[model samples]
Structures are given as structure tokens and as C-alpha cells.
Target: MIIAVGSQSKIKVTAVKNALCQLGVKADIEAVKAHSAIAEQPFNQETRQGAINRALHTAQLVPRAAFTLAIESGLYWRMDAWLDIALVVARFPDGTCVEVESEAIVFPSSAVEEVQRRGVHTWTAGQVLQEWGQVQSHNDPHLSLVGKSRADFIQDAVVKLFQTLQARHLLSV
Candidate 1:
């Protein structure tokens, strides 16, 4: 199976490979830059549209592939703070589509505001957290607060998301 990954970011490439490995999927995967944009604010529609845009673009570029994978993520204030939510959209050759979404624990608002204030155009959840000086806060009570690095958190979430997708039979190798 040939799978076209919609982005060329290191984190996304690693996440996709790790997800495929964990799911026992055997396929040839390649990364192609489908869109040129960064996250500014969080919204459900924007996230979905980003993924859809990438998926459609990649599909045009890699027409022979079994399916195209697109991932769009953003941080939103849920409950009281920003939470990382990534939604994956898959487009098959026959025009069918499937979507999967994964979310992390809410992030503190101070962190989000600080990052936004810095005018940083390219920042991930991990970078945003680091800017807030919470990298070493071992006592902060939150979900998955066992000193888990942001990278690890995203990896776990992607793996779980792959599981969720497979259970739904969205894609198969």
C-alpha cells in the first residue's frame, strides 16, 4: 500500500511511522508538502478544513496512492485552558473519506496567552508549554502528569488515534 502523508514536519513523519508500526500496518509512506500554513487560533471548522485541504492536495499529487493522510491540530480553551486537539482526515481513491480526532488535557490559559503575545508564528503545544515555564513543574495536577514530555504525549495520542481509526476500518494495509 502506498500512503501519502500530507506534511513534511519531523513530528508528523515520526508520528505517522510510529502509528503504522503500532498498528502492524505494512505500507510504503511518503511525505509531501500539501499546504503552507500555521496555526493561529483554535476552532473546529478551521481544523477540519485544513485537514481536508491537505488531503485533497495530496490526493492530486499522488493519484496512485491508496489513500492520503492529513492531520490538522490546534489548541483551544476548553474548561479553562487550551487543549491540544488533532484531527486526522483520510481520503481514499474512490472518493470515500474518514476522520479521527484526538485531544490532550487542557493547557493553562496563561501559557496560551504568553505564546500568543510573543508573536511566535510557529509553535507547537510542547513549545508553548515550555515558554510558560511548566516544563519542570512536576507537582501540577493534570491528566497524564507523570513527567510526560509533550512529544511523548503526542506520540501516545497518535497511537491511540491509529487504534481508533483501525477499529473503525477507515484504512487497511
Candidate 2:
């Protein structure tokens, strides 16, 4: 099977690989450059839309692939605090789509402020966290704040979506 992933991020790619492994499937996976079409720090709806957009865009890029996967991370405000959310989307060649999401984690106020006030990207905020020794990687801060690795979070979402497709008999193998 040929699978196309929307982002070049190692975390996202590894998550897909891990999820597929859990399902006992193997495939040739490729990463394609795809845009989220939303702000660097997107809100609830924007985050979901971004994930969908990336999946659709990657599907268009590799139309022959059995599946296209997209993962998007964003921030949302709730109860006077910012939180982190992740959305995963999968698109099949037959025009079927599935989506799953990660639980929200309360984000660091300082990082959120920097993104909102200085117009910095979430990645930049992550970098700041790295400098403070709060985060060990550039792509994930949830590791420190929520005690959950980014790969695990992404894998959970992908696994949920894949299970849904399997339960519905929408996916073969």
C-alpha cells in the first residue's frame, strides 16, 4: 500500500507509522508539502479545518495512494486559558474521510501571549520553551506540560480514526 502524509514533520510521520504497525499493515509512505490554510496558532474550528485541508491537499498530490493522512496542532481559548489541541484526518482513495482529535492540554500562558502579542508562530513559542528547558523538542511542548509525548498523542488520534474506518468496514487491511 502507498500512503501519503501531509506534513514532513518527523513526529507526524512516526505517529502514522506506529499506528499502521499496530494495525499490522505495511506501506510505502511519502511526505508531501501541504498547507494548513489557517493561522499558525489556530482555534477550534480552524484547527479541524486545517487538518481536513491538509488531508485533501495531500490526497490530490498522491491520488493513487491508498490513503492520505494529515495532522494539525493548534491552540484554543477556554475558561480564560489557552489550550493545545491536535486534529488528525485521513482520506481514502474512494472519497471516504475519517477524523479524530487529541484531548486539549492547558498551554503555557507566556507562550500563548508571545504568539498572540508578537505575532510569533507556535513553532517559535516551542523554541522558547526549549530554551527554558521546559521542552526537549522543537515540535512538542506537551511532553513537558502534559507528560504525553507528541508521537503518542498523534498515534492515539490516528489509531482512533483507523479503528473507526475498520469498524465501519470502510478500510481493507
Candidate 3:
């Protein structure tokens, strides 16, 4: 079996691989450096759509893969704060699709502004945090601010999405 991932980022790729293993699904992964065609730090529904776009793009790139996965991180404004979340999307060969999101982390206003000032098209919050030495490249910054690793949250979302697929009879594992 094969799984196609829509990113070359090591963090995202590892999260998907870890989720699949935790769920007892064994498969080879094909990682593609896909462009979401949106702001790197997408906001609102753009984040979700970014994941979908990536997954769709990966499916096109690896047509024979059994599944395609994508995870897109973005910020949403709610309850007077900026909520940073990673949205994970999964696509099956039969056109089955499902999505789930990591639990959000509240980013301090300064960090949010720093990301905004740097230009969303050019930098993601994680990259800004990386510049500050809060995290490594392509890793999440929530650990420094909210005590949660990027991979943990994203892996959790992927696990939930795959389970949803299984429950819906769209996936066997």
C-alpha cells in the first residue's frame, strides 16, 4: 500500500506516518513538495481549503497511491485572540475526503503581529518562531507558547481523520 503526502516538510510527513502506525496501518509514503496556492499563513477557511488543495494536488502527482494526506496550519481569530490550528485532510482513491483539526493554541498578540508584519506570503508563524529559536524549521511553535509539540497535535488530527474514514467504511484501517 502507498500513501501520498502533499508536503516535503519533515514535520508534516512524520506526523502522518506516526498516525498511520499508531492506527496499525502499514504503507509506504510518497512526499511531494506541493504548493497550496494560498498565503503560507492562511486565515479562516482558507486554511482548510489549503489542506484540501494540497491533498488533491498530491493525488494528481501520485495517481496510484491508495491515499493522499495534507496538513495546513493557519490562524483564526476568535474570542478576542488568535487561534493557531493545523487542519489535516485525507483523500482516498475513490474520491473520499475527510478533515480534522488540531486543538488550537492561543498565540500571543506580539507573535501574531510579528507574523503579519513579516508578510503571510513569505513566512508562517512557525518560521517566525524558528527565527526566534523557539522551534526548528517546519516544526510548530506551540510548544514554546502552549506546551504542545507541533507533531503531537497534527498527528492527533490525522489519527482522528483516519478513524473517521474507517468508521464511514471509506477506509479499512
Candidate 4:
């Protein structure tokens, strides 16, 4: 099987590999550049759409692949605080798709202020978190807050999505 991933980021690619391993499916995985079709700092539903768009875009790049996976991280406002969420979209060869999301972690008010009040990207906030020694990677500052490794968070979502696909009989190992 061939699995195409939307982003070239190591964390995303590793998550895909880990998820596949968890499912006991062996395949060649490739990472391709794909557009999210949303703002650099997407929120809520926009984040979900970005993941879907990326998966669709990746599917276009590798149409013969058995599955295309897109993973996107974004911030959302909830209960007067900003929280981080990772959205995953998996597109099958038959034009069917499954979506899943990670548990959210609250972002520091300062980091949220940088994005909301200063028009800075969430990645920039992640950089700030890195400077403060609160996070190790700019791509997943929630790693610090949630005490979960970046790959683990992403893999969890992908695993759930694949499980859903299996339950629906849309995927088989």
C-alpha cells in the first residue's frame, strides 16, 4: 500500500507511520506539499476544513495511493481561553474520507494574545513558547501543556480515524 501525507513535517509523517504500525499495515509513505486552504491560524471549523483540504490536495498529488492523510494544528476559543487542537483527515481511494481530532490543550493567554491581538501566526506563538522553554517544537506547543508527545497526539487521532474507517467497512488490512 502507498500512503501519502499532506505535509513534509517530520512530526506529521512520523504520526502517519506510527498509526500505520499500530494497525499492522505496512506501506510506503510519502510526504508532499499541500495547501490547507485556510488562514495560517485557523480556528474551530476552519481547522477541520484545512485538514480536509490538505488531504484532498495530497490525494490529487498521489491519486493511486491507497490513502492520503492530512494533519493540521490550530487554535480555537473556548470558555474565554484559547486552546490547541490537531485535526486529522484521511481520504480513501474511493472518494470517502474520515476525520478526527485530538484532545485540546489550553494556550497561555500571552500566546493567544499574540495571535488574536497582534495578528501573529500561531506558529509565532509557538516560537514564544519555545523561547520560554515551555515547548520543544514550534509545531506542537500543546506538547508542553498536555504532557503528550507530538507524534502521540497526532497518532491518536489518526488511529481513531482509521478505526472508524474499519468499523464502517471502508478500510481493511
Candidate 5:
């Protein structure tokens, strides 16, 4: 299967490929440069909108791909906590469409308050991690603890997340 992800970020591409591998699916994965104003703040409409925008944009760019995926992670605040939820919008060559969603990882109140106190508000998950001290120990400050790379401490968390998604059949059509 050809899985074309609509992002040039190597971290995201690796994560998606690894997630697919764990699901026992062999796919030819590649990254494409697609731009979209994806709202980082979690809301159903914004989440779906971002995914759709990217999927369509990338599909237009890669007309020959069998499958394309535009995945975005949005963070929503709920009761003094932040929830990290993933949204994926997929399209097949024949115009078959599927939308798969992942549950939220609730961040502690302390983390949320610290973020707001810093006056650093951004929808990007990488930015949120930097606002906190999560990247302090890493040599590469931009690397996400919850993203691609095996040495990341958050690998287990990510793996468990994808497995959960698979178990729920979120990856299936």
C-alpha cells in the first residue's frame, strides 16, 4: 500500500510509518509539502477542517498515490486540563473517504496553568512542549518527546496510543 502523508516533517512521517508497521500493514510512505492553517485549539469543526484541507491539498499534489492521509493533532482545554487529540482525514484514489479519530491525552492542570502563565499560546503540539521544560534535556530542542524517534521517552505513550487506535479499528475503512 502507498501511504502518502501530507507533511514534510521527518518526525511525523516516521511516526506514521511506525504506527502502520505496528498495525501489521506494509506501506510505501513518503512526505509531501502541503500547507494549511490547521487550528491547534481543539474543536470538532476546526479539527475536521484542518484534516480535510490538507488531505485535499496533498491529493491534488500527488495525483498518482493510492492513499493519502492528512493528520493533525489538536489540543483542547477541559476543566483546567489540556487534552491532546488526533484527527486523521484519509482519501483513496477512487474517491473513497474515511475519517479516523484518536482520543485525547489529558494533560495535568499544572502543565496547563504553566502554559497559560507563560503567555505562550500556540496550537502546535511541539510549541506546547517547548513552553514547558519537556525539551530541556534533549540535544535537539525541536524534537518532540511524544513524536517519532525511538530514544524519546514518550515512545511508549505514542505506541500505546496508536495501538489503542488500531484496537478500536480507527485505522480500518
Candidate 6:
């Protein structure tokens, strides 16, 4: 079986591979750079659509892929504070899809505000945090804040997505 992942990020690719391995799935994994077409700091619905777009976009790029997967992380405003979550969307060849999210973590409102204030389309929440010495960089952010690697969140989300699809009998692979 061939699985295509819509991301060039090593963390995401490895997380998906790790999740599939934990599920006892053996297949060829492909990673492609696909745009999410959402805001640099996606929130709410943008997060969901970003994941879906990545999955469909990757599937379009890799026609022979048995399954296509993509992961998107964004913040949600709830109870006065912003919560960050990772949303993973997986698509089957027939255009069927399932989605799952990682546990939400607290995101500093200051960072969100800074990004919003900058009004730059290229700025991300992570980058804002990085500038303020919150994290090392835009790549592996969870480590400093949550003490968990971003890969951990993505891996868990992928597993949840896989299990959800399996429970619904939506995944044949």
C-alpha cells in the first residue's frame, strides 16, 4: 500500500509513519509539499479546511496513493484564552475522509495578538512566540511550552484518525 502525506515537514511525516507502524501497517510512505491555503495562524474552521485541503491536494498530486493524510494545527478561542490543537485529516482514494484532533494546549494570547497586530500574512503564532523568546523557532514549538514534541501531538492525532476510520469501517487498509 502507498500512503501519501501532504507535507514536507519531517515531524509530520515521521509522526504519520510512527502512527501507521504502531497500527502494524507496513506500506510505502510519500511526503509532498502541499499548500493548506489558509491563514498563517489558522483558527477554528480554517484549521479543519486546511487539513482537508492538504489531504485532497496531496491525493491530487499522488494519484496512485491508497490513502492521503495531512495535519493542521490552529488555535481556538474558548473561555477567554486561546487553545491550540492539531487537526489531522485522512482521505481515502474515493474522496471519503475522516478527521481527528490532538489535545488542546494553552497558547499565549500575547503571541496571537502580536501576530494579529503585525498584519503580515507570513507571520505565524509560533514565529511570534519565537521572537519573544518563548520558543526556539517555528519548527518544534511544543517542546519548550508543553514539554512534548510537536510530533507527539501529530502522532496521537493520526492514531486517533486511524482508529476512528477503523471503527467506522471507513478504512480498508
Global lDDT of each candidate:
0.69, 0.81, 0.84, 0.82, 0.59, 0.86
Residue 88 C-alpha lDDT in model 6: 89
lDDT of 1: 0.69
Tens-place lDDT digits, model 6, residues 4-106: 9999898899998898889876779999998899988888788999999999999999999988998999888878898889998889988888778898888
List the candidates' TM-scores in order.
0.73, 0.86, 0.88, 0.88, 0.62, 0.93
For 31-67, candidate 3 gives per-residue lDDT tens digits of 9987788997898899988888898899999999988
Better of 2 and 4 by TM-score: 4
Which residue segments of model 1 deviate by more than 4 Å? 36-44, 115-129, 136-146, 168-170
lDDT order of candidates, top first: 6, 3, 4, 2, 1, 5
Residue-by-residue lDDT tens digits, candidate 1, 87-165: 7777888877787766466666676676677654654444655555665532222333444454455556667766766
lDDT of 6: 0.86
Candidate 4, overall lDDT? 0.82
Tell me the deviation in Å of residue 148 in model 6. Answer: 0.9
Lowest summed lDDT over 10 consecutive residues: which window, candidate 2?
Answer: 118-127
Worst 10 residues of 4 by lDDT: 115-124
Candidate 5: Cα lDDT at 114: 52
Question: How well does candidate 5 score on lDDT at residue 157?
Answer: 37
CA deviation > 4 Å runs, candidate 6: none
TM-score, structure 2 vs. true: 0.86
Q: Best candidate, lDDT-wise?
A: 6
Write the number of the candidate with greater TM-score, choosing between 1 and 6.
6
Evaluated at residue 152, the lDDT of candidate 5 is 32
lDDT tens per residue, model 4, 1-173: 78899999888888888887899867899899999978777777888889889999999999988889999988788888887878888888787878888877788978767666656443456776777787888766766778777678888888888788788986677
